[model samples]
Target: MSIHRLIVKSAALLTAGIAIGALLAGAAAAQQKLSFLAAEYSAKTLPFWEQVVADFEAANPDIDVTLEVVGWNTIHDLTAQRIAAGTMPDLVNTATIWVPEWVDAAAIRPLGDDLVDATLRADFVPALFDKGAVYNGENWGLPIAAAARAILLNKGLLAQAGFDPDAPIATWDDYRSIIVGVKEKTGAFGYAFDAKGVRAFRDFGYYLLNNGGTFFAADGRAAFNSPEGVEALQFLVDLVKAGAVPDPLGTTLEDYQPMYEAGRVATMINGNFAIAGIKANAPGLEIAVAAVPVKTAGQTPVTWGVTDTLVIGKAAPVEASRKFIAHIFSTAVRNQFDEAEGMLPVLLSQAGNPAFTGDPNIKAFIDMLPTSQFDPFHPQYAQMQELVKTAMQSAITGAASPKDALDKAAADFNALVK
Candidate 1:
C-alpha cells in the first residue's frame, strides 16, 4: 500500500462522517413541532398564541408550532377523552380551577426546573400561581390571566339617591341602603340580580370567603352548610324579599345589563368581559365598579377571581411541550395576550399598561386578586354548582328553606366527592 493511497482513504471517510452528521441534524430540526389547545376556536385565542409562536420560531428557527382553538364548552372534557383515546395535544388550556383535579388524576406532568423562570415565579402573584399551578403540593400549570367578578354600580343612580358617587358601598348593609334608597328616589329597581338562577348565589362565593367559609373545605368536603354560607345566600334572598331585586324574572348575568341600560336597575355583579355589553347598552350612563361588599364588620372583602391556565397534558411530548408553554409565559407574549383579549394582564409589571389601563373597570378585576378566591377546587365543582343552583331555585320559590336547601346540597356534594 502506498502512502498516497492511505491518506486519500482517510480523508474520504472523514468527509462521509460529516455529511451524515448534518443529515441527522436537519432531520431533528424538521421533527420538532409544538402543538397548543386553547379555549375558544376564535381570534381571541389564536392571535396572541400565534404572536408568541412567531417570536419563538424566529429565535429558534428550527421548531414548528400548531395552534388549535378549542371552545370553552367542551375543551376540558374533550381533552380528557382524547388523551384517554391516545390523541392528546402537546399543551392544553384549562380553567385554573381544574389544576387540582387534573394533577390528582395524574393526567399531567410536573414542570420541573427546566421551564420555570425564577424571576417570573418571584414576580408573579403567589396566590395566582398557587391557585393555578400548586395543587396537592405540586406545580402543574402557568396562570395566564387573572380575573374577578365585580359589582358594576351605577354612579348616576347613587347620586340620584343622595349618596356619594365616589365612595364604594363598604358593606352589605351599605349596599342595601343605597340600592333601596335609589329605587325610592328614581322609581327603578333597587338591585338587579340573577333572579331565578345560580350565578347570583355562586357569585356570592366571595361573600362566603370574606365571612370565613369556603364552598368546599381543603379536604374536598362540602362546606357550604356553614353559617357563613347560609348568611351569604340570605343576603341576596333578603334583597329579593325587600323588593330590592327586580321581579324574580329568572334573569342571568346578561339579563341585568339591559335593565341597567334602561335605568331600571342600580347595580349588578359580573366579570371584566361584561364591560363591553354595559358600554354598548348604556353609553351615556356613568358607571363604576367596586369589590363585592364585605359581609361582616371585620371581614376582609374578597371576590371571585377566575384564571385561564396553560397545562401540558399527560400525553404531551413533555420536553418539547414545556418549551412552548414556557415561551408563552414570556413577558412580551403575555402582554400581547391580555391586550388582545381585553383581559387583565397577569404579569405584575404589565398590569398598568395603557392598553389595559384605560379601562378602570378592568382594574377592579386586577385589584381583587389579593383577596380573591379561585373557584372551589373539587373535580365535581360543576356538579356542585348544579346542585346548589337547584337548591337555591327551590328556596327562592318558597319550595324549601335556605337552611334546608343548603343542608341537602351539602349532602349531595358530599356524595359526589365520595
Candidate 2:
C-alpha cells in the first residue's frame, strides 16, 4: 500500500475511536439516578423491591434506581433524619396520615394529572385513592398498600365457650355476651385489646366509629368526647373492668399475634394481614372472621381501612421518578405485592384477580371495603393519635374515668387545632 493511503486509514481509525468514547461518556452523563425509601411491610418486602428495581433498570437503561427498605417502626425517623440532612430520597413509601405533614413542609410534589394520567388514576380503587391519596383537593401520593380491619375469632375457643363459631355478631350486645362467656367458661381472655404504641388509638376507634362517633366534627372541632364517644370508651373500659381483655394498658396489636396463635385469646380485632400471620404461625388453628360488631342490629357495620402511600420528593427528577412509580403500580406488580404482604388490593383492576378472590381470608376483608372508614387526615394527626392513646390508657388503668380522659383529650386536640 502507498504510505499516504496508510496514514489516511490510521487517522480515520483514531477519529472513529474518539467519537465512540465521546458517545459512551455522553450516555453515562445522561443517565438519571433515583433513590427510593420504602417501608418494610414484611420479610418479603426488600426482595420484592429489589426485583422491581432490577426489572425497571433493565427496561430503562438510562434511568438507575436505588432502593432502601426499612421497618415501619423506623422508616419515619429515618426519613426525617434524611430530610434534616438535606438528602431526601426521590421516592418514599409512608403512611397516609403523614402526607399532610409532608405537604405542609413542602417536602413532596403534588401528583397532577400530567404525571398520573387519567387512565392510571382511574385504575386505583376510588374509595382508597379519594380518601387516602387526595389532600386539599390535589392528589399528593399513590396508594401502595391497604388493609381492612376485621374481627378474628378462635373457633376452638368460641366452641369451648358454648357459642357457635359461625354465628354472626350483629350487635355490640351479642359480641359482649360471647366475649364474657368465653372469659367465664374457657378462662381465656375474651378479647385481645391493644392500648399501647402510636397506633393504639385504633382499638378505641373501632368502638368509637361503630357507635356513631367521629374524631372531629364537620366544623373541625374535637368531637370524640361527645356522648357517643364516651359510651364507646366506657364499653371498652367495662370490658377491661370485667377482665374480658388481658393487660389492656400493656399490650400493643403486635403483642396479640402470638397469644392468638396459641389460642390464649377468644377474639381480637385486627387487619387482614393478621390472618396471614396466624395461619403461618399456627397452621392447625381454626380461625373465623366476621364484621366488627355495630352499636345496634340495624346499623351499618364499619371497619378501618388503612393504606400506606408512595410520594415523590420535591427535589426528585419528577419525570423519571414518575416512570418508576407507574411501573410499580402496574396490575401485575401490584397484585404480587398485595398477595405477598397479605394486604387488600389498592387497585380496582386487582379486585377480580383469582389469586385474591380465591382466598377466603382476602375475600373476607374485601367484602368489608364498602363500609370501610379511614383515619381523619389532619396536619397534627400523629399528635392527636398520641392524645387518644394516652386517654385510652388513662381510662383503662383507672387513672381517670372514660369521660374525664376523653374530655381532656378533646380539650388538648381542640387546642392543637386552634
Candidate 3:
C-alpha cells in the first residue's frame, strides 16, 4: 500500500474512535435521576402509583425514578426537615393547601407549559384544575385527586335504631339524637371521630363550617373562637363525653375501619373516596350519604373540598420531572387512578362522564363542588392546621374545656397569622 493511503486510513480510524466515545458520553448524560416523595395513599389506589412509577421508568430507560411513600401523619414535618436540609425530593405528592406555604418558601417550581399543557389542562374540572392549581398566575402543581367531605352513614345501623333510613340528617341536634339512640339500642359507638393526626383539623372543620364560622377574621387573624367556633368545639367534646363516639384523642379513621366493617360505627365524617372501600370491605351493608349535619335550623348544607397535587421542587431536573408528570396525567392514567382512589377526577373528560354522575353518593359529592370552599389561603397554613389539630385533640380528650382549647388555638393562630 502507498504511504499516503496508509496515513489517511489511520486518521479515519482515530476520528471514528473519538466519535464513538462522544456518543457513549452523551447517552450517559441523558440519564436522569428523579426522586418522588409522596404521602401514603389508600390501600386501593397505592398500587396504581407504584404502577405509574414502573411504567414511567420502563418507557424511559434513560431516566430513573425513586418512589418513597411517607406516612401522611408525618409528611408535613418530614417535608419541612428535608427542605431545610436541602434534601427536598425532586417531586412531592402533597395536599393542595400545602402549595401556599411551599410557594412562600420558594420550595416548589412552576411547572413548564408542556407539563401543564393546554389540551390536557382543559380536560380537568374547571374549578379544580384551573383555579386550584394556579397560583400567582402560573401553575405550580399537577392536581391528582379531588375529594369532598361527607357524612358516611351505615343505613342498616340506622334502621335497627328506629330512625328512618331514608331521612336526610339535617340539624346537629338530630345528628346527636340519632347518635344517642344508636348507642342506647345497639350498644355500639355511634360515631368514629378521628381527633388525632393530620386529619383532626379538617375532620372537625365540618362543624366549624356548619356553624357558619370562619378560621381567620377580616384582618387575617385567628377568629376561630367565635360563637360558632366555640359551638363546634363543644359538640366534639359532647360526643366524647356522651359516649356517643369512640375515644378519639389518639386515633385515626383507619383505627375505626374494622369497627365500621363490623357495623359498630353507625356514622362517621369522611370523604366520598371511602364509598368504594366500604362496599369492598363490608359488602351488602346498606349505606347512605347524608348531608354533614349542620348547627342551625334552615341553614344550607355545605361541605369542604380538598385536592391533592404533584409538586416539583425548584431544584429538580425540570425537563425529566415534567415529562414524568405529563405521562401519568394522560387521560387513561388519571382516570384509572381516580377511580381506584375513590376521588373525583379533576378532568371533566372523566368527571363529567355518567360513571361519576350516575351514582347517588358520587353525585352528592359532585354537587358539593359548586359550594365546596377550600379554607382561605395563608402562608402559615401548615402551622394553623397543627394549632387547630391540638385544639380538637385536647378538647376531645378532656385535657382542656372546649372554650379553653379553642381560645388557646385562636391565640396561637394570632401569633402566626400576623
lDDT (CA) per prediction: 0.74, 0.87, 0.81
Q: Which regions of candidate 1 are displaced past 4 Å?
A: 1-29, 41-43, 50-61, 195-201, 247-249, 356-359
Cα RMSD (angstroms) for every candidate in the order listed: 6.8, 4.4, 4.5
lDDT by residue (1-418, candidate 1, tens digit) is 8999999998899999999999998887677777777786235666666667788888766667777777776787887786677676777788776666667667778766566667767756667776566766777877877667888878888888888866876788888898788878988887776645545556556567767788888788888879988887787677778877775547875677788877888887777766765676678988788778887577777777788887876666656665676677766777777766656677776755776667777765676667777765677877777777766666777687778888998998898886
Candidates sorted by TM-score, descending order?
A: 2, 3, 1
Point to the candidate with the largest lDDT.
2
The estimated TM-scores of all candidates read 0.84, 0.92, 0.87
Residue-level lDDT tens digits of model 3 in 1-418: 9999999999999999999999988887888989998777676545777898899989989888888888777887788888889898988988777787788778888877755667876776778766676766777887777889888788888888998866978899999999989999988878888877677887778988888887878787887788888898898888888988888885788888678878989888888888888888889877788778789787766678888888889889867887787788887887787777778878766755665888888887887788787656667777778898898878876788888998999888887765
> Which parts of model 3 have CA positions greater than 4 angstroms off?
1-24, 44-46, 57-62, 112-114, 134-138, 352-355, 397-399
Greater TM-score among 2 and 3 belongs to 2
Encode model 2's per-residue lDDT on 1-418: one tens digit a residue. 9999999999999999999999998987899999999999889999999999999999999898988999988988788788778888989999988888888878888987656778888999888888787888888888889998989999999999999988888888999999899999999988888788777888888888988888888767788898878888888988888888888778877787788898889899988877777899999999888988888877767888998999889899977877887899999999889888888888888878887788876788888889999877888787778999999989988899999999999999889885
Clashing residue pairs for model 1: 40-70
